[model samples]
Target: MTNAKTLGQAFDVLLQPDKFRDYGPNGLQVEGDREVKLLVSGVTASRALIEAAIEAQADAIFVHHGLFWRGQDGRIVGWMRERLRLLLTHGIHLFAYHLPLDAHPELGNNAQLGRLLGWQADGRFGDQDLGFLGVSTQPWSRPQALADHVSAVLSRPVTCVGDMGQQVRRVAWCTGGAQGYFEAAIAQGVDAFITGEISEPQAHLARETGVAFLACGHHATERYGAPAVAARVAQDLGLQHRFIDIDNPA
Candidate 1:
């Protein structure tokens, strides 16, 4: 077993939460056991995930999305109470890393997705440098082909907005509901923009701007980073770890 305090300290050092301004508190959102023997990672700290982790006998749950958003009501009621009740009752530690998990160059959602898609990242842009700007290893002569590749890699159908045969080279991506950053991505002159979620205006923007757009499921795109980081931490601390994937269609 590893001490939760020590593991959290290591995470703070590794992730450096202080570097970014996030929507929610960055680390150790809900404290539980002092010692962690089995650690589980997931995309969000939902009731389903908490119950699954409890069933799996996980001492802690590591996640990309955590409770207590910036503008959310602070009361422990409704869905929040249900989630917290599970964690508290099971004495499971909840550790969340939002922007930090997305921004990490090597193990981040953007980086992992880039690696999976065979994109060569040259730089980062957008808010707190959360967006990745890259070039596809293989020139994409058709938007549909790129969409197919993304769908294959993510195992989820992708919605594309652009000419089917449009050629694309430079690409920009930011995982998890970062459609607002498309403007910044457009400013970068990327031929295509890939993000977790897309707003309605983006369809018009894609058509008018002649830049391709793909809404690749927020949960699907952001699933890799948290588990990778969790596994790394568990390995470092000599604790057993498993990634509990609570599939989200969003």
Candidate 2:
């Protein structure tokens, strides 16, 4: 058991949800006890994740995607009902940082990946976005080599959308199932676009736009925020910690 309030304060300071006009709420979206000890973090706040949180007896759960979407009818029935019931009944607080997590400079998924790949980050684009897109000082060993490296780093296999024989140049990427933004990256004239998740339309767009696309897995790409958030919580509160990675292939 640890001091929950101390943890929340640290995460809020480090994540700064107010900085980004996010698609959904961020920083303690669902309320539980004011203070927390153990935290469960994951890519999405689904039923399984919530169940895991209950089993862990976590004080809070930090996730990239939370419930209550843009068009989700205010109705609490069906799938939504079950999930909400689980969270509320378990007394677990849920904090989701959507675009804000993506926009964080030092701790965002893009920023962490840029450092991992040694890419010189060019801070976000429209609306002053913050997903890193930058030039590579040196070309990778090969596109496959880089993809392989990404797979190794992300702990999941990535779907390569262009020719394996192709080489990579200036690449633009956003983490966590953002394949929908491939067109935007293409408009920027990127040699490649990297993101999590892919759709049939993505293939057509990739070829048409002449930009390589890679679906590096929604869960895999977005794990950075929770861990970084966890680390900050640990540092600020001086608590024993470990970042639990729930391997997800999607």
Candidate 3:
């Protein structure tokens, strides 16, 4: 068993949460058992994921999306109270890293997603440099082919916009609700832009600018970072780790 504080410190060192002005707190959100022998990692700290951690006898939980965020109601009631009650009652430590987890060089959401999709990040853009500019390892003859490959890799339907026949070579991407970065990516002169979600304006922009847009599911694209970081930490600290994937269609 390792001390919970050590685990938190390790994450802070690796992720450097203070570097980004994120939407929520980045470190230990909920205090639990001081000694953590089993660490459970997931995409989000929803009720289902917490219950799974409890079932697995995890002493700590690490996730990308945590229970609290800035600009949220401070009062602990309804779903918030229940979620906190579970963690407090069960003594499961909660560590959440939002922007840091997304921007990490190797184990981050963008890097992991690129690794999965065979894209190499050559540069960064957008707020806090969260967006990645890259090129597909193998150029797809058409945007549809790239979309098909992404859908198959992620096991979810990808919403592709713009000309279907448009060739996809140079690419830009940012995972999880990063459609807003589409315009900035287009300015970089990439042939295609991939993100977790797409907004209405992106469709029109794609048509007008002749840049392809692929909307992979937000949760699906972000599934890798938490698990990847957690596993590495667990290995280094000699703690058992389990990655519970609570299916999220969004």
Candidate 4:
């Protein structure tokens, strides 16, 4: 068992949440028990995940996406109220890290995804250096080959927006709804850009610039960071840890 504040402090030290200007609060969004023995980690703190945590008797829940965000309705009602009620009723602490989790060199989503796909990050690009510039360790000569590899690894159909014959060597990527960074990645002279989602303009841009684009599912790409960080923290703090993957098709 460990003090809840100590766990939070450990995460703050490792992730440095304050360094990123994120869309939502980055740490300890909901307070619960003062002590935590078991930690549950997941991609998002949706109702299903919370219920699973409850079932597992987790004292705290760590996630990449939290219950709250900027520009959202401040009032606690509807789905928000229910989520809050469950946490409060169970006395489960809620901790979330967004951009900080994404940007961490080793434990971040981009880094973990790169490691999973055998890509090497050589540099960073885009806003706050959230996007990664990398090269595939294996020579994926064609866009289709890279897309096929991504699909097989992520277990979800990848959406490719470029000619199959396009030669792909250098690559850039940012996980989770970062299609806006495509042009910035293009400027870096990468042959391909991979992200969790793609927008309409990206298709046109891929055609015009001949830069291949791949949209792996947002939830699929971000599944690693929270669990990886949580497991390390749990090991360091001598607390039990469980990662519950509530599958999300998005």
- Estimate the TM-score of every prediction: 0.97, 0.84, 0.98, 0.98
Candidate 4, 95-205: lDDT as tens digits: 999999999999999999999999999999999999999988997999989999999999999999877787888999999999999999999999999999988899999
**Per-residue lDDT value at 158 in model 4:** 96
For model 2, the stretches where C-alpha displacement exceeds 4 angstroms are: 1-9, 126-128, 163-166
Better of 1 and 3 by lDDT: 3
Per-model lDDT: 0.90, 0.73, 0.94, 0.94
Q: Write model 3 residue lDDT over 107-212, tens digit each, in one string.
A: 9999999999999889999989999988889999999999999999999999999988788899999999999999999999999999999889999999998899
Write down the TM-score for model 3. 0.98
Q: Candidate 2 lDDT, tens digit per residue, 113-229?
A: 777767887646544475467877667645667677778877778777665556777888888767777777877767777788899999887766557788888877787876776
Model 1 residue 190 lDDT score: 91
How many clashes does each candidate structure show, in the order listed? 0, 4, 0, 0
TM-score, structure 4 vs. true: 0.98
State how far residue 87 of model 1 sits from its true place (Å).
1.1
Q: In candidate 4, which residue pairs clash?
A: none
